[model samples]
Target: MPRLRANDIEQDKIARFERIKKAITALEKQQKQILKQGDLAPEGAWVARYQVSQNRKKYWYYKLQVPTPSLPCATSSKLSKYKHLGKAGTQEHIDAVMSVFRRSVWDEIQRIIHTLDDCLLDISSGSEQEEEEAQD
Candidate 1:
């Protein structure tokens, strides 16, 4: 069997990323369905609470809290805090939170693809230079 070329490897990666893109699209579409079925709440919880301000005014607001571990080297003895998400009880807020998470994942995928492209460019250029030198 012959050794695989760079193009062949890149083709495989491209196909894999395309499949990942499809999966992301599917997840995005299911966001609404999951929310309606109350399946999304398994990931975190939300609350509507009243608070008193310095002016003695009371107001009720919704917040989404997620339990996560504190920093590894934190001096505080507390183990975790309920991370404050955007305002709850609204579709826009939920979408915003989801977008934030999805954007992070998409950004990471783009970064990896960029790194791969850079590496392939370097390899192709080096091979081309070697071929040119041999011809001279």
Candidate 2:
């Protein structure tokens, strides 16, 4: 009977390491994007969609929507509707919020990636051990 080959296990470990590295790089890239969001407003704003009748023609209009827990934002209005941005300002509101959203996303991803560091190190050490054993 043939003994099990370490090469197969080494390859598998190498593949896993490569995957982890890719994930780390991707997370770094995402964090960079968040950093590039420029200055962010302290107030959190959102746009809500509603139907309006314009000369008997129906059209959708957007306004700064109410803040939700998901966004966790601050607004200029303590407890009032947002009209400071004005009508047709949905795009502006969303753009303003991207910084906050990106920051949260980046933070969450980094937190998750931090937990994988130990696993990465273990994989690396195991791979080296397997390679050395195979060479013997």
Candidate 3:
């Protein structure tokens, strides 16, 4: 077996780095596709609670705990804290759940893209350092 020279190893690393870059580009395209899927209201959290009616019939209700936008010199008030989404199994409830699920998927894709970017940076920097040492 022939011994691999430092230059040859560096070139191989560069090739792999380019491949990763292409993969990241593809992920970005998919991210855009996700945005175009449906309504992406990625704000607030869905809340579910059980309540008893006057006749002691227990039922579940869903609400969205939307955070009020902060303003300058705003007082601590409980205004527009939660918006009712009707009872469970309703269209509003189902839509809310699906919105949350889509947001989670979007977040995961962002995390993956960031990790790949970091890896590319690490590999490029290592290669630069190696080249500097080889010149000395």
Q: Whose TM-score is greatest here?
A: 3
lDDT of 1 by residue, 88-134 (tens): 55674665456445544545555665665565555445542354445
RMSD vs true structure, all candidates? 13.4, 8.9, 6.1
lDDT of 2 at 11: 87
> Relative to the unseen true structure, what is the C-alpha lDDT of residue 136 in candidate 1, on a scale of 0 to 100?
38
Candidate 2 C-alpha lDDT tens digits along 9-85: 77888898899888888888877776786644334444456777889898765555445433333554245544333
Best by the lDDT measure = 3
lDDT of 3 at 86: 81
Quote model 3's TM-score.
0.71
Per-residue lDDT of 114 in model 3: 97
Query: Any residue pairs clashing in model 3, and if so which?
Result: none
Model 3: residues >4 Å from true position, as ranges? 41-44, 66-79, 127-136
Clashing pairs in 2: 43-74, 44-74, 46-65
Give the higher-lDDT candidate: 2 or 3.
Answer: 3
By how many angstroms RMSD does model 3 differ from the true structure? 6.1
**TM, every model:** 0.35, 0.46, 0.71
